[model samples]
Target: MRINKFIANSGFTSRRKADDLIIQGRVKINGQTIYEPGIQVVDGDKVEVEGKLLTIEKKFYIKLYKPVGFITSNFDPYNELDLNDLLDIDKRFFAAGRLDKDSEGLLIITNDGEFTNNLIHPKFKLDKEYIVKIDRKLRASQEKKFEKGLDIGNGEKTSDAKLEYLGNNTYSVIIHQGFNRQIRRMFKVLGARVIELKRIRIGKIFLGDLKEKEYKYFSKDELKFVDEMIR
Candidate 1:
């Protein structure tokens, strides 16, 4: 297998991230640091990423209803609530995408690297749906501006998004772009503050009846649905 694919199969991260690691000279084949991501690895060949041995692991796909105050990452330097602790399984899984600390809702936890890449990579143009509660009611003008896209700072403008007003200061927001704190930033650009942001769906997968901090493995049908979508 290719070196980047090998690293990804080891459950470290996505193939794209593995390529970044290879380019950074953080990947080694039999103690020789290699900056080439396309290098091939055969059986019995030793592969290491960031000085740690890489081994292919059993893939896992889980859906989690992440709660507020918990961070998505495994390594929390600031000693905050970690989402990993909620899963008691032996396998290590990372969030396919991230929700900010204050955000609550659906998170796909998986050890499949290619799967992670397919879900979050901008090239896929996957729709992620969220229900957001703002500090005030959304104005028609601001809603139009949001649907047409807005400058969210740092010279980046969000792609056109779909905004459905849900009443009571809440709206259903759908965005394909994965900018940092994107939903909040989009609202901020319109002089609105997102008081609550909860992701309800990613493509065909839904949060469903999963309560806060609850999780469940993806069903076979759901997995097939995701596979078809990504393909």
Candidate 2:
């Protein structure tokens, strides 16, 4: 099979990212550096990524309610906080997307690299819902701007969004894009200060009574719904 396809099949990265690994000289085939993207590999050929043997076994998929103050990374060099410390596992897993340190809500940690790509890529157009509380009252004009997409710091405008006011400084907003600190930035652009932000849903999966700092695996039906949505 082609080198890129082989790397992708190993579940190390997507086909596009696999090409990057080849160009960076991080992938080797048969004990030789294989920088050519179109190189072929056969059975009995040894494949290594960044000097570690690549294996396609023991994939894991899990969901957790990420609490405030905990970083989303598997390890944090500065704060010495690691998400894995909360889980009982020896396998390596990565967060599919991200929730900022100050934000709290549903987060998926998994070893299934392919599922991570499909879930995060914009082509899937899956919706992520959040309930946020702001310090200032939302004005009517600001509400229209959110529906039409606002200029939130980036040179690009936010994608169309669904916003509903829940009264008493609370509102529910659903967005398709997962830009960095996107929900918080949008509110800031409207001259509002966010007091709290929590993601409540990802696609058909809901936070579902999971308390802060709590965790649970995706149910069979929830996993099936996600698979069908992306497929």
Candidate 3:
């Protein structure tokens, strides 16, 4: 198999990350350091990564309460706190989508790339709900803009959104689009900067009472619900 695909099938990391490992000379096949990303590997070839055996189990799915200022990556060049450090699991995982470092809340970590694609794909229409705190109060017209959907300014209009005021500069909203910095950009377009943004829900799964930086495994029923959501 292709080196990247082999690494991913071993559940070590994503195919892209596996390519990085190969390029960095950290991956070896049958005791030979393979720096070429295109090198293939067979079942009988012994593999080692960073002097550790390159063997891994199946995929995993987990939910974590991501605090602010941490990146959703296995490695960070800027010396930032990676999402892996927040979890104590033995298996390697990657974020499904991503939250900006300044934003916080529920983040899904999994080893299944296909499943992640389905969850984050725009065509699936999965709803991502957030509890947002804005810097200023929203006028009635601003609420109308949110309800009717606003021009995202890239010539693309955002989908219709649902908003509910939670009093004291806070409100909850559900949006189908997952564009980069979407919620922030939406509020920015409405002249209200987001003071705080927390993704409280994905699909029908809620964060419930999970505390800061805490994590949990999805129940069988919860997984079923998530699977059905993408269908």
Candidate 4:
């Protein structure tokens, strides 16, 4: 199998990211640096990425309602807040995508590296929907701008977003791209401050009734839907 797929089977991260490691000279095969993502790997051949040995195993997937103030990273060197502390599960899992520290809502947690790739890969065009509440009511012109995408400053512009007025200070925004602090930054660009941001959906999976910090494993039906979508 290809080295990128090999690292992904180890459950470290997505195959896409593994390719990045190879390009960065951070992946090795039998103690030799390997920059080719397609390099073949056979049984008995040793592989390491960033100095850690690799292996494949059963994958675990979870859907968690990530509450504000908790980060998505495995560990945080500052603030001392870890997402794992909110769950009782023993296995190591990673957030498929991310939400900022101040944002809250549905977060995909999993040991399936390939699923991570599927969720965030640009070709998939999966819509991540968020209900955002700003300090005041949003304007129609703002809606048009969101539809066309926004210039969030510093040469970073948002991707095309679908918008729906949910009345008052809230609106539903669906975006395909996952730029850093995308929603918040776009709102800031529009001269408004977002009071709250909650992700309600990712593809066909809804955050659904899960309270803050609550989590559940993906059901067979849910898994099937996701697999079909990714496939």
lDDT of all the models against the reference? Answer: 0.88, 0.83, 0.82, 0.86
- Which whole-number lDDT from 0 to 100 does residue 22 have in model 3? 88
If candidate 3 were superposed on the true structure by all CA atoms, what would the RMSD be? 6.3
- Tens-place lDDT per residue, model 2, 53-172, is 875565556778988888888877786555866677687778888899899998987776667887888988889999999997789999989878988775867989999999999999
Candidate 2, residue 148: how far the Cα is off, in Å: 0.9
Instruction: Name the regions of candidate 2 deviating beyond 4 angstroms.
Output: 1-6, 15-52, 229-231
TM-score of each: 0.81, 0.81, 0.74, 0.81
How do the residues 130-214 of candidate 3 rate in per-residue lDDT, one tens digit apiece? Answer: 9999998899889989878887788778888999999999989998888778888888998999999999988867788899889
Cα shift from native, residue 121, model 3 (Å) = 0.9
Q: Which pairs of residues have clashing backbones in candidate 1?
A: none
Screening candidate 4 with a backbone cut-off below 3 angstroms (N, C-alpha, C), the clashing residue pairs are none
Candidate 4 structure quality by residue, lDDT tens digits, 90-166: 78778889998899999988888788878888888889999999988767887798789888878887778998888
Error of 3 at 138 (Å): 1.0
Looking at model 3, residue 161 earns an lDDT score of 91
